[model samples]
Every structure is written in structure tokens, then in C-alpha cells.
Target: MAEFSDYIVYVDESGDHSLTSIDPDFPVFSLSFCIVKKDDYTRAVVPSVQALKFKYWGHDAVVLHEHEIRKSKGDFTWLLTDRARRKEFYEDLNQIMVDAPITIIASVIDKLKLTARYPRPWNPYELALHFCMERLLMFLTSMGQQGKRVHVVFECRGKVEDAELELTFRRIVGGANQWGWVSRDFSVMEFEPKFAKKSVNSTGLQLADLTARPIAIKTLRPEQPNRAYDVILTKLGQIKEFP
Candidate 1:
């Protein structure tokens, strides 16, 4: 009889994993895991995001995508017309992220350095996933959640990408990772991967989406002021940077 964990983790990524033609502006690939207790997710995070949507859109149908909001495209087009509303919206949204009782574990891969070092480098996404998943297990173990079943939610990329990610995730969680041992007591936490489409409007996935870029940017340019990253630092539990 396996018991479920009181926490759920949402995953999102920033930047493409492709080593070829890396964007000079944002060369790093980052994966963010937003871990939230079920109670806090239900009682705080969801309502706040929904309220923010309703306040501006008069409905909650609008998904909170980091790219869309930043670019004022898609459902966020109106934001471009009204600077005051946009500023207010951002302020409120930033406050919500700061106030949310969530833990973020992120991994950043410097693709430029990675390709420069290795003749044959592993896929940046897979490498970052491995790092985050290992730390995720460690975080769960620290919280006395060993043997507990925790669901990790990831936004679906495409069919092939999603399939590959799922496979990699299962392999790591099944103890096929760098640390080859599994405890008899099942001290390693069990994680079930759940994939949701981007249109699903998941609060956790959105929060994870909002976090990935900031962490990646901070890693790439530590001196640059990132207000979003500053807010995210409050919830950051662990951050891993890889060459």
C-alpha cells in the first residue's frame, strides 16, 4: 500500500536544448521544479492566480504563460496597450509568486561550455532533468517523504519530446541514475510523471514556467537585475548549474 505525498511538483523549462545555433542572448537551458504542498496549492496558489486573471480578463480562461505575458502576445495582447494596467498586473503577479508557499529546485546547463568541453555531450534537457530529479528525490527524502508517491507535472512539449522526457524521468526514478543503489526501506521517493498540455491552464505548471527563465537568466548574467528572479529567490530550495 503506497501512500501519496502531500506535495506535488510542477516542471517547466527555459531555452531550447539544442546545442547547435545557440541563442547568444539566452544560451543556457534550465529546468525548474516547483514543489508545493497540496494544502498550500489548493488554499493559496490556485485562488491567487485565478483572482489575478479574473481581475484583468473578467474571466479565468487566460493562461498565465511567461512568454506570452512578457511579449504581450496571444491572450496578453491587451497588456501592450495599457502600461498602467500592465505594471499593476505585474506587481500583483510578482507578489503572488513571492507569497506562494512553494519550493523551487532548478537546474541550469551552460550549453556553450558543455559543447566546448565534450566531444559528444548528452542532450541538455536530459542532463538538466537528471540533475533536477536527483535533487527532487533528495528534497523529498529530507522532508521525510521517502517511499511516498509524489506526482510531478510537466507541460507537454510535442509528442516525441514528451515521450523522450517521460522515458528519461522513469529511468532516473527507477534508480537507473548515477547513484546505482536502492534502499530496502525504499528511502528513494517515488515520482509519477503527469503530462498536461500547455492549454490546460495548470497553476503549478504556470508557476514553474514563470520561474525557469529567471533562474536561467540569473545564471547567465548574475549581475543583471532580475526582479522576477529576486522574487523567485525567496522560494528557491536548491539550484544546480552544470557545464
Candidate 2:
């Protein structure tokens, strides 16, 4: 089984709420979690990523669209599609998941629908990102209370143009101590954006993307129900209950 330790966790997001800023559509956001094992951080994450540099051209390496995976070879194709290969990959991944002790919490909002029901004070993207981060931090706190030290690293959402997103994230982290998301005297560090982008292309981010896609699709097809949530939850197998 994988073992836990003091590790660096990386995160990234996908999709935007620009078009929906006025008349909201689907406000989808993703949070990917990846951790570098204390002992094998360099070998496991850094080198593997460096090897994939040749394949980055003309492909959506970050978001990883399904169509592109269907056209690739080696790691990308095996990990993204090809069910048999994915099953084997997960079997191996179980060890890493247990050892590195990682989790990703992604939350999305169907903005057009949500605003129509209950309006929010901030932009949908900003609100959804903060909400997801809050839940993620809450989960981390609960894990820490169980005696785990987690160092969270996030890919900055570029230089935030919207002051609300900046303000909200600052407030959330600053007030974490007051809100019990952090212990009475614990400190959390945020890392630079590119560090997360350089992390391994693990299933965590792909799974988060999977979770967000259906929500985004549902905004246009209100008649359709989101089944990706259940599909991904089943695949992850660790998330028994979602908040």
C-alpha cells in the first residue's frame, strides 16, 4: 500500500465563465490534485513530465479533450481511454494514491440555472472556484485532524482581473484559522502556478475534468441529468460521500 508523508500537492482548473458573466450558462470549474512522494518526487513526477514534452505540441495537454486522446499513443492513450489499460493503470495507481495520500474536490455550478433559481453576489466562476476550494480545504483539515500534514499548491488562475476572485481567495485562506478549516495555529503555503502545471498528468485532473464536463453540458441540455458525477465517483472508489 502507499504511505503518507509530508508532500507537495499541485492543483489546476479548467473552463471559464467569461461568456456567462452577463447571462450565465454553465459555470464549470475543476480542481486537480497531484502529490509528489517524499522519497521519489523527482523520479515519479519531474522526469515523467519532462519525457512528455515532445508530445505537447498541437495538443490540449492541460484540459485533455477526449478526441485528442483517441488519436494519441503511449501514456496518453492508455491513461485517457482504453478501458482495459485504464483498469491496470488504476491498480498500480492504488499504491500511489494510498502512499502519497491525495484527494481532489471539484465543484461546479450551472450558472444559468443557478442564477435563475438563487442569485449570488459574485461572478459564477469566482464563486464556484472559492466554493470548491473551501470544500477541498475542509476535507484537508479533516484529514490533518487525523494527523496528516498537507501542503497545497494551486495553479494561479492567471493574474486575476476580477478583484472579487482575488479578494475571496485571500479571505478564505486568511480566515481558515477562524473557521476551523485550519487548526488554531497552523499555517498553509500556496505555491506558484507553473509548478502545478509541471506535475504529472495523473488521473486526478482527468477525473476532475470528467466531473465538470457533464455539469457544463447539462446547462445547455437542462433535460439531461448528470451521470458523470456517479461515473467518476465510482471510478475513484475513495469518495464514498460527496459534500
Top TM-score model: 1
Question: What are the runs in model 1 whose C-alpha is more than 4 Å off?
Answer: 178-187
Which lDDT tens digits does candidate 2 get at residues 1-243? 122334545444445655346433434443434433444555553333333333444333454433344345543665655677666544443333334333445544444454566544345555554555555555555545324444455433445543454565556555542322343322343311232332455433433333445434533454776444334443231221111
Candidate 1 C-alpha lDDT tens digits along 124-231: 988888778777777788888977889999998889988988998887766565433342222366678999997788999999999999999999999999999999
Could you tell me the C-alpha RMSD of candidate 1 in Å?
2.2
Candidate lDDT values, in order: 0.88, 0.43
Give per-residue lDDT, candidate 1, residue 194: 95
Clashing pairs in 1: none
Model 2 off-target regions past 4 Å? 1-7, 19-67, 70-101, 119-121, 145-151, 160-167, 176-231, 235-243
